[model samples]
Target: MRSGAPIPDFGEAQLRAVLDAIPARVALIDRGGRCRYANRELAEFVGLTPETALGRTVTEMLGEAAGVLLAGQGGRALDGETVRWAGWLPFHNRAERRYVQRILLPHRGADGTVDGYFIFSRDLTELVESERRLLETGAQLRGSEALSSAIVASALDAVVVMDEAGLVMEWNPAAERTFGYARHSAIGRPVAELIVPPMMRRRHVDGMRRYMETGIGTVIGHRVEVEATRADGSIFPCELAITEARLPGRRLFTAHLRDLTEQRAAAAEIEGQRTRLHHVEKLSAMGSLLAGVAHELNNPLAILLAQATLLRDQATTPELRRRAERIHAAAERSGRIVKSFLAIARQEAPRRTLVRLAAVVDAAVELTAYGARSAGIAVDVTHDPDLPPVQGDGDLLGQVVANLLVNAQQALQDRPEPRRISVWTRRAGEGAVVVVADNGGGVPADLKSRIFEPYFTTKPAGAGTGIGLAICRSIVGAHGGRVELEDVPDGGARFLVWLPCEAAVEPAEAATPDRADESLAVLVVDDEPDVAESLAEILEIQGHRVTVRESGQAALAAARRTRFDIVFADLRMPGMDGIALRRTLMAEQPQVGARTVLVTGDTVLGASTARARRDGALVLEKPFTPSDVRTALEQALMKRDPPAS
Candidate 1:
């Protein structure tokens, strides 16, 4: 039928012919469900001619159920409401189904009395089945969409979808957790601005634009590790895998991202462990070599000192006495140098001490200034006197300062006049900041990053080892601090060391002068015969009865026999190591074990250091002198009850 149109005239023959030839299932029924008129299509559906169908009631021609249903609809039209519904009508063959879309309208009499109904019916079997199939397909598609959404919601790795314009379209639950952004805020926002750091946002935007224009992308279809800024503005590392999809006239990108912060931390830890392992290995090799060298040199050194001492005390000639004094002084100085070498060889993991920055900086400056001023470099020091102390290894921090000072001095040496080094410490945030700047040419921007990397140096062969800055970084890192190079406005290089500040100062212990007076029996243990006897004789001169043992097994035998008041054991010896010997003594004779002195040039760290501290035994480094031996005995004596004195 036509839209917004009334029923056409049915009184004319031409109009009646039009209705009969309409190819629709058209019919007109009376108030009694009797057919008044039937089109060619309707007549065929009834298996009767239009003239014969007019006298039959619908309930008689069709079945009783369908006829009653039709009668109710026709009754509504009789009362002035247009009724439209899709219902099945029986075909001529009862076994066949006939579906039709029907409309019923009221036809009023000229006298205003209710008249019969006018029914217009249409056969929609083909259209109805097609819609049924369409509805089923739609349900399936809806289910698939729901499943994809669930998968995205439950994904452990973040999934993000953005449009060709780089605006976020869909952000899954994982994305929300990953970037700390709500889905509502993330969607419809520019992706580059949302998660990309400001420094990289321009590049991200340009790259996206270029890829959209040229169909070539660097990030698309590639998994890359990138720095992503979170909603809180904190940046972290993330691994991103992106794939591009083109739909009709639109393009979209889907990314799978995983946070790499923990992975990066674990990797750094592994690398640090590897470096420490290497350090230990090198320390071990050097320890053995130095121990042997110290042993060989100590025998002659002991002889020289003993002979010089004898001459100085008993000489009648004043000139001979003065000569012996010089010889004695030389031997003592050499002994100090050997002990310093042992300290280097057996470098222990630094024990943390609460110390002020000024003291540490002053100590380093005292050591660095002489050489610095010798090169005509003026040194200036500035400090914020109120700065708090930090919990760290003072010696290690001093080493860091030494490295920076050495680097600054070397830089100044090659520069023109007006060479100067400025060192200062100040409070910055929750940290103590130290800056060492020099009036030498500033470091190149390109080289600044590699300066702290191990084995990376610009100096000529033998002029410098590449490990200075690397060691500085390691030491600072161990203290939970940071060291970085910054640009100086004065056209100089400035290195900043940042150490975390402790909230409250840990009080320093009161110092007591050494009171190592009470001396008892002492044992000297070593694999070298001359080294052991020389150390014993030196102790014997200090008024302690001394015994010499050339091995850990021999030392253990001596301790078992005499419960010595003091035991000096070499770390590396035949049959048993110093650690094993000490353990056996500690288990059998706890009193003698309490006074054991273990000396080493080896890398005695970790478990060894822990055990040494636990046992309260002294571990003096090797390349010791007569004095180091006496000092050990005195400390052990202080720990004891002074031998009933």
Candidate 2:
């Protein structure tokens, strides 16, 4: 045989070379379904040589089923049609062992007649098994993504997703509910414009842009509270949390929002209630102060009147005149005390003006001198000559200073040593300062801190109203100042009040001298006989015709009988109060009612002074001077026709 020629290839060398060269197993079959030729691999698989396998029917070598399948495929090829089949075939050498396979390409003659089939079979079991596993894994990944999306959709807090450019990518159902916008409307809109408040819209847009450009965030990755505008044109507060993430080539942000409107409203309501309670406590404190002031006034008035009556019965002498002058002074001091108490309890509109601090202190000291003398306390005054004036209600500040003097005197009443109260005025930085110091046992350590608190007092129950210092503090505070208690190194308590002073000097009001009073009939009504008598005497001395009635009912009856120019009636009389009497008189005799002047020593009457004024009547606070009484009587008389004889 030639070197490259086809060998008469029953030789093992040629067979082995052909088998190795073929990519697949190649076998040849005989007419009886027996193996006539086999490649090296096929022969090895069957555990037989080509010579041993030749002319051996497949049914004799392997199984009947294997033989039948081989014969059927070969017969189809022989009919001049290319045939291919794949199935499980039994191995000749292995008993009852099968291999899965596929066969390819049959051989046919050029005359269009089949000669025999050339078969190539391959094992494909592992490839089919690998494909099954891949399909299962793909299904599981899809299921996980679906479950995650479902969870996000069902959340209660508003969830919004945005692209790097701040355009809304996804808006969940919760977002729709919170922002009052439908998911469809929000999905394609810019998130900043849709959800951010108008005031914050520009900032939000800039922040998002900066974060996208430079990864510097103003709000991203942080939770914050902000106001959001809703579709209804109302604004609601909300808490927002933003988180940034990357998906593919795009950056995304997710925001979670929670509404805080109800919470904020609840907090504001609670604060309002607390403020109301504080006012109620303040009023209760005022009630106590009123009682203390009434008691303080009554004590001096009783003594002064008793002394005056005794002096009136004595023989005329310089000493007697001096004693009578002292009594009159005491009575005047008591009158001032009542007036100050009425002013504090009354919620009168402030009459603000620039006032001298030194003058106020001096007036307070003079007014409380009699009481301080009675209490055996000496008052010393220290004033800064160059102290600046303060803008405030002069009467109220004077009342504050008076209250401090009285308190200081009372605190030192029982001390064994000579008790001394000092009134000091000075300029402190840009403000005016008034200091009232007393050489009392000093404020108790436990009570010092609470001295300015309303309703807090060291005096026994029913003695002090606890509101004096509180009112003082409030008045000073209203003038843009502060009141505080400090330790007096000389073993006493010092109360210092600082008030902001006017930067420039103000011109003083021109003083007007009092004119001689024209005689006018005045009716004085009071439950206390002495109060009525004292008022009648004061009015009579002022050159006014005066008549005294002990009750509101008597005043009304007296007004009906006599055409008096003015009816001065006490407010808290029994049977009929001053308000009721005025209404009755108005209904019965309109002219007389119009001239009705309501007067009361009770501080409570201050509360209704405005209403009384609105009703076209003059209101005179009790414990007034003869001058005040004369002025009110003149005003009332001027409004009325002269009394008919």
Candidate 3:
């Protein structure tokens, strides 16, 4: 290009083309505040041709005030600073006025001094309107969070906040009361260290760490029931919820906790009362059962004993001796009845063991077989070969089966057709079932519903106590099983008992004692001379020195004086019962109190028995045999110091 000639440089044309291609309006203003050059977009934006815009000062085109505004902006641009302004500006051709943004950028000469200004203006009316809407939206969001916070604080449940570090960040008023800590005291403390029980603290910390790392949670977003400790060092139950929250730079957790102390206590109280009511009902039924059992065993025993004595006096032949043997067998059966009653009423804890269902069924059948045969009833038993062993008390289960069989036989006595009592045992899914069915006149539909209810017997006043079925139900329930009655298709009623089966357990071998000729002094205390003398006789037979006292006070006095190796005292004696006497003795000589055994006929003293057991005293029910007395005495004596001479 020539130095000062007007050259058609392709580079300048390309720049012009690029500027004209821009969507935004573009213009050029000289240092004197005159519009020197305008691009096509700017010309169209102002509704003027580029030739008309050229060499026009702002005052000549728009007026004096507009001219001064433009001149000031040009001066700012000439000072080498970009000037930007945006507002509403009127267009000559556009019907409606609109908002626009004007950017003024200074252009420099070859000497690095500002020569002119390049201005670009964009119509940003839509963008400014959108920004206004966004500002309103932000205000709404802030109001929503405030409202939510207020609602959560007003909730009845205790609210707490913790940061990702598991430190308490906020504690509400409800939380203070629930945790027995003030808000000021709880804030900034490690949440797990403060609220979690010692045993669960480490687990809670680990869970928090895991959740933070993998976004995996066990309790988050879910409500859970757990144990909580209060500031008083007392533990209580609680329901809790944890939720995750996002913060600007970290994560947080909000916990809602509800105290379940009162709920749990009320539930426990109701359960205790229910158990007590059940026990009371059981005792009432037992009273009726005692009456029935006594009635059933007494007549047979009197006949057998009387006949045996008569035959002993009048026998003259082998046939008479055979009859006497029959009398003896009958008496033995009566004795077994008494034993069963004693076992049912015994205070001893259940001895749990694995017992074969078949063995228990066979034994029970044998017990009632003679009576059923005598009543002209045919007995049938069917056992599944695949039946599994059950964990239970063998004697108690045998009693249950015996009771069921006896009830069945009694039901069929007046039946006209073939009287049949069938007992079936089979393996059920995941359990075993024992069914006792009778083909007698089926239970009256009305009576079937009440058969298992305590004291609701269908038999004539003296024949049944109505407790057998109830006891069977209780026994089955205690084993975590069920007892139900099903209707037989043809006739009669079926009682099905389902019990969980367990692997067979081998019986523990009896331990042999070392031979030692150590003699122990034993004290026997009872109000009844017969009972005291019986116990004394048994103790003496066991090679122990024995003394008898008729009252608890007397027993206490004797214990203080003699230092006996063991004291077997009747629990219900007059003037200081076993508990009071034991307490007095314990206060005086704990050693003697520890060696004491409580003997009573009343098996229904629930809390009294519980307290005695808690205090380490052995309880024995009455009507015990000589061997029973001997074993109890030996065990108690072995637990005490040697008796002084």
Candidate 4:
């Protein structure tokens, strides 16, 4: 215990017991690298007893590989220096390697000189393995953090992390781009103040507070759509999802945000297209029904119109004439209504003709004036006498005018009384301009751009089809014209229709010039008995020898013997219709065929009718008056013997 003091000298038994109890392999080696003394533990480690291990060299006790490491340390100790070496060594008794720490201290004689050294080796395998595992775990954690940071940086949606107090803790690159803020400016700022819209900021703060206090979140773990504000104060629709992360006593929230502006626009466009498609399907079905109706009703209506006209012309007295005239007038009105329905059906292609703009406006006004008056809205119409005619379909142009008037009337439904609509036509440049103005609320600013779009409407649901303006634009466009809304200064709105003017051409007047007071042999062919009888009577009254046939077969039989000056045939018959009858007659006698006239009640022509017309066979649409009948006869005469041109 004291320096330079050797007190009691224990026997070898006491020394061996002390060395064995130390739990370390202890040995003494002389300067020649051979073991001089060994404790019980050191001797057992090399598979030898204490007496057998004595006087063994380092290489013989451990292994050649183990001795090489210890030889250097022992040589250094012999040179009067204490040496420490720690490494893996395989001892003679163990098959596996052991991590050992060896300390070699020099033991010198009483004189200041180097001597043999003592060796102390302890096992440190478990401690070294634990330290190595700790280092591996640290590397794994760092790698995981790096991967998370890279994903957040490259994510398409905005990634934002906020602390418990709602201050932004992490602002990824996507967040900076989405919120219009740089990372430096966003971090440490209240996230709600940065991206939450002004109207939603209070709600966001309250939600965060509630979650922090009660641990309940309304938006957490769920995706929601909300309005978000940009740095420039613009608000946009944003899809957001939030997640809560709790560490120890602190809470953090991560939000993922995606802008929904384009997505919402696309969805709205698809809906509009769907509505338009549905409307088009309905219109197509309605057109088919109207076409069928026209075919069925025109036959009876034609008989009524022709009979009334003939009876009026052949009336005996004043009273009979008046009654016949009234019947004829009623039939004419019915015919007009049918024509209007045909126009609405849109079953026929537009027929281009020199249309008087003034007449079209007046007719449209008269057609809709009753509805306007019933709604307590006064109507005013004026047309310029000097306005030129436009080459377009008269019925279609009238429809366009009527649609404008009806739309104006509907616009005035919710307005106060004393409402009025005014229509005016004038000559502008080389075109005719018709302006329809109404004293009602004008179109909204936001709806102006989409008003012409199919299925877009401002009228209350079920009250409007939403295709009125779209149809108007289409008709006008087809006619090489344009319709537009002209802003009214005071109130209401003005709709202007501008159509290019065309030189007017008068309808040809058909007259029997060669036989002024003479009648020709005429044959009338019709499937209906009344129709054929009425037409025959009309022809007979004109001093013509008329023959009535109920079917094309009957007409063909009669026409074989008689060289009829003209043949009148109904187009749509039960058997051997007009086209077939005409073809057979032309094969036999080209003159009679050339003078043939085909009549029908159908407004929509078939391909056969079209072919007949192309062959120069005159066709008169049904519901014909006495004048129409005369025109057909004269046209057939002109075709049979064209004037010597």
Show where candidate 4 strays beyond 4 Å: 1-139, 143-150, 161-169, 176-256, 344-349, 443-456, 465-467, 477-480, 487-490, 503-511, 605-608, 641-645
After superposing candidate 3 on the true structure, give the runs of residues whose Cα lies further than 4 Å from its correct spot. 1-374, 378-389, 392-403, 424-430, 441-478, 483-494, 504-517, 605-610, 637-645
Query: Between 2 and 3, whose lDDT is larger?
Result: 3
Off by over 4 Å in 1: 1-350, 354-390, 409-413, 416-437, 445-471, 484-491, 500-516, 560-563, 604-616, 625-627, 638-645
TM-scores for the candidates: 0.43, 0.42, 0.42, 0.65
Cα lDDT of model 1 by residue, 1-645, tens digit:
222222333223544555665545666666666676676777777687866776677776667766878878888888888787766676444786877767676654434444666666766565444334433443456535465566566666787878888898778998999899999988899988888999998899889889878988887865577999999999999978676655556766777787878656644543444344445456567666775576556546655665556567667998988987898777776655554343334456787878789977876776677689899999899999889999987777887887799899998888899899999999999999989999898888899889998667888865765778999998899999989999888698999999999997576853432544545677778886765776677776677788888888878888878858788887667689777887787778766776778876543322564566566668765455566666777666556432321
lDDT per residue as tens, model 2, 161-221: 7777788877878888888899888878988778887888888878777777798886675
For TM-score, candidate 3 versus 4, the one ahead is 4
Cα displacement (angstroms), candidate 4, residue 595, comes to 1.8
Clashing residue pairs in candidate 2, if any? Answer: none
The predicted structure with the larger TM-score, 2 or 4, is: 4
Assess candidate 4 and give its TM-score to the true structure. Answer: 0.65
lDDT for 345 (candidate 1): 40
Task: Order candidates by lDDT, high to low.
Answer: 4, 1, 3, 2
lDDT of 4 by residue, 1-645 (tens): 222222113234544555566656888787677776787788877889877876678899888888888877887898888787667887666788888867777765434465577787767665445334433443456435455566567666788878888898778898888889999999899998999988888898898888878979878976577899999999999877686655556666778787877656644543444354555666677777876787677778888998888889889999999999999998987776665666565445678988898888877887687789899999988889888789999888899999999999999988998899999999999898999999899987788888898667888767887888999999999998899998888889899998999865677865556853477999999988888888888788888999888899989999988889899999888889998998898888888888889988665635666677777778988778778888788777777543332
lDDT of each: 0.72, 0.69, 0.71, 0.79
Cα displacement (angstroms), candidate 2, residue 565, comes to 2.1
